[model samples]
Target: MEMSEIQAARLLLGGDGRAGQAASRQVGQESASVRYGEVKSVDAEAGTMTVLLDGQSQEITLTDSTASTRLKAGDRVKIVKQGQSWVIDLAGGISRALDTAVSEANARMGAHDETMAQQQAAIEAAQAELAGMDRKISDAVDTAISQLETPDGGNHIYAGADEPTPPKDGLKAGDLWYQTNASGQIAAVKVWNGTVWNGYDMVANSILVAGSVGSTLIADGAVTTAKITAKAITADQIAANTITGAEIRADSVDVNEIASGDIYCKRLTATDGAGYTEMTGNKLEMLDSGSRSLVAIWVEGGVCYINANLAEKISIGTNSGSVLNISNGGFIFSSMMPGFRVNGVSAVESFAIAPGSATESFSANVPYSPHKTSYAVVYYRCTYTDTAGSVKFPITEGGSANVVLKELTAFEAADESIALGCAENITVALGNSPNKTFAITRGNPYRFAIKPSGNSVNANPGSQFEITQVTLCGQ
Candidate 1:
């Protein structure tokens, strides 16, 4: 039974009902108790409640039911007595309590559902916005790629072409096309410089100098920028220093010029075919093919005169002589025909036999048996005369009249003394004589007599003597 507070309060305070005594003193504790099964209809206006117990319903009075003393269905009512009418029940007590709980639970569920719906809508909106932005970004990328044109008539992409397909010419997506020299080598790179397309450095490869593998020659390029030089130029030096040794070897230099030490060729022969003197300064001159004269000179005369000009100097000794004869004994002779003499006295000397013409053949073995048998040998000696005058001697056969000196003995003994016997001090000396002297008379028969002088003089002119043959006896 549901009971109103007014009815229960009247029962407890006034002791007006049968159950009043039972409920009265119990009020000092907390709320009064009611039997749930005994509840009947609540009467909110009468402030009392009826309850059924033991199959019978009754009206029980209560002291107070709360302020206005009204009750209704759904209110939580209580029966404070054993017999209480439905009017004494609390007003709408059970119903009101159950409604409040149901309302509160519905409100919370509604709030949670509303909040979850909002979150879902927000997520959907964000996804749609992101999809639209992706489309715009993709459109911008396409515009950028279309603006660029590669050398092979293709577009350029940042990372790569769409779908990463190779270019139509099988080139990389961002790659440019250019011509190469059949070696599959990159001739040059034509790339974009942010504003325009331009070619990077393009240069022709170099060739080695002929016959020189390590040497190099550039066909064309700016030497200052191309970095060309001789082998002596180190790699680091080439990079650091200015480029030099820049030349085009169209034709070789003259061999004569090279042989004469006029020009230098680094990697060419000294006698190159193009007349080039492949002479190089501070470097070696090498042949293109065969061997060559490394350090040689070409002489043009009949004799190769390397040192000073001693053309007419004779090599005279006790065993050798000059090729030509001088007028006087003490002189140096030459080999030229009708030769000349240097540093010789030529006052009155005559040829052994008159020359083939004015020129005498001082060649070997063309005269009478000469004391100096060799054509080159002749004797030299000085003489002192007691008369203090010059002497004269004839290089002829010694005889009284018609005489023939077959040997040296005949020539020595055939000396006819037609002069006075002056003295041993009165001497007749012999100078360089190619042929043996048959007769010699120093003085005239009317003056001082002749004498034999043992003094000696050099026949070779410069400090030497020569004897071709030895003759012991005078004819």
Candidate 2:
């Protein structure tokens, strides 16, 4: 038979069968020291191999005794040193070692996963505890804010240094207490009537006993006029003669309150006997010892009489109206005097005269006694044409334009010739006419005449000369 390659390699090494076998056994033992590497190169015919050991390339001779001849580049293999030569083999042993390493790595990964889960659970627990703490803190803050006495909470009433404590409970209707009012000031005693507290002033409610002399309840000057009701005090309440002249206000007493016959005197005459004597009657009279009444006041009738001549003149009415003026020498009634009645019949004659033509003359007969002094006032209006003409109008009492009379002589003589008075003349311009009035006093039968100035007295046609209204007043 042909000798195997291993036997031929042993003969060349000069080894007999037994010695070769023994040497082979020793090589195999040495080759059992295995390490993992990668095959870098392989040459099957040369029986040479290059393997990477410890990150370095190493040459290996593949003898016939080598186990695998199918090694190729990039193949994981097991390398062993055998008697000054390296041997390359299939990576069976390496594969077994890798399986063990894989098992250890998987165990470590499982442990890491367990640790991460535990850490996550701890984080979640910490978050939950933090949230609970936050809620507790918020509740505590809310409780503190609610207890404050600000505008958002309780208003107006808060205990201060000088203020009273606010009532908290046990409230009843009309129960009295104290608190701050709406004005933020300490109020007077306030009453509670189920719903709200009502404030009241204490001083205004207190009452004082009448006739109590020395009571300290009311302060000095505290009682004013506003506090007293109308007619609160009567005469019975006031002490006798307690009010003085200084205490009584001016004009406090009315005239109606005084009793009649309160004023009296012993005599009207002075001690020097220069005044008149007082006389007793229904009238208040002052007289001389000769029993002649000098002055008298009729108290019941409200009339006054003077027997003696008065030093000053008396004026009865104002200047604008009828005036009955009495002087030392005489008395006169002015224009517009209302006539006196005789036996309830109208004694005075009044005329509402219409305007006459300027060319005509007008006349009126007045009831006048020739022996008695009488007065007449004439009011006339004259209208003229637009021409340069002058007109003189004369007011005649009798037929003549001029009549003379002495007033004192007329009254003394009582003769008609002495009583008849003169006529007065008033001139008017035709260009600018105006109203005129005049007053005359006479004691005669009178006929008033209005005539033009010239003998051939003719007014301009359609021109008006009139006595609109005439009042004849006498006393």
Candidate 3:
């Protein structure tokens, strides 16, 4: 993340500001700079952590216990100046692009494994149905072979000459030439050799019918994929759950073989999309590589939660386009930013002075609306210590970045008409405008200051004019 982009960054680097001049470190104060990094490793015993900053690894000590508790490897942290020394803290709002990329790769591999399992199950079912058909074909082949005769080099169909006609439905008499058994029976009469026989014999003009195709006729391992017609076996031929995991070969099925359908998986990833979708805790979530929600939908107890995530802003509208857009810049509706009059004023900035001492003269950040609302009132309460004078606040731009500035903005609160008197236990509400609402920008924090309105500070540096509370009102 860029240092300049960090909202929490307090910098004193010698970079040219919006103004021509850059701020320099003043005497007797430590200069500081803010930078971001990823934690590589943490050693609580050693009081240090190895961090990757700007593509380089560097070791930094953990001086703050709070920061140490929040840090771990793969987490990002920022090195910032705190008081007199540099300290490490978790970096808020910094981009974690590297970690997100790694997550996406892992998700893709998981999806691949799940897809392979489903394909294997489907292919195995087809193999079982193929085996069943092999039994039926074998029996038909054997019946023809037994009736073969000489003069045919290989088996061929029999001719009508001296050949018995085939049966219509079942085996019958007169379909073949029969010789008398050892018992010496008459022509076309029943006869038996040794085995027990049923009382039946061949009759005239009757035909022999083929018997059931027996499993014993077919040799094991005779049928294979080469013997079957392509696409002949379908789902109807294969029984459900007939194929088990043991019947499948490793990596036998691939994506090319699978037809388009719904894929159910624990984790599904697509590299082209750079994200993953998964089910967790009964909620289905689709997330980007960064783990930020891209889109999600789930139902529980008749209630559904649908989520779509966008950075910094969200818009809602019809098919035409967006009618309402909510962002850090504030709500913009149909090409217009919402406007409220001064009567709708609210506190935009507020801070308390020390119990007895006033806050030091420094450039602290103040909230400003992107729509450029105007501030109108300066309010404060001070208990007087026999002191009588007014302290008007004059806010300005281009304040120094130092923790303490030796000079102040040219405008004094006195230069403006508004006056805040130093009276005991009294509250003051002075109308401050024209100067209070200075140069502004959208969606950014501006720098405001508290300093002497003249000799009010250098002469009376005690609780005589100490502010109990102060608030900046904007509309």
**Could you say which candidate leads in lDDT?**
2
Candidate 1 is scored at a TM of 0.19
Clashes of 3: 5
Whole-model lDDT values for every prediction: 0.37, 0.44, 0.42
Question: Per-residue lDDT of 278-342 in model 1, one digit per residue for the tens?
Answer: 43333333332444433322344554322212233334344444343433243333232333222
Q: What TM-scores do the predictions have?
A: 0.19, 0.22, 0.21
Pick the winner on TM-score between candidates 2 and 3.
2
Model 2, runs deviating above 4 Å: 1-36, 42-48, 52-58, 63-75, 79-94, 107-111, 114-118, 145-475
Error at 455, model 3, angstroms = 99
Which residue pairs clash within candidate 3?
167-208, 170-209, 171-209, 384-423, 384-424
User: What is every candidate's alpha-carbon RMSD to the true fold?
Assistant: 34.9, 36.6, 46.7
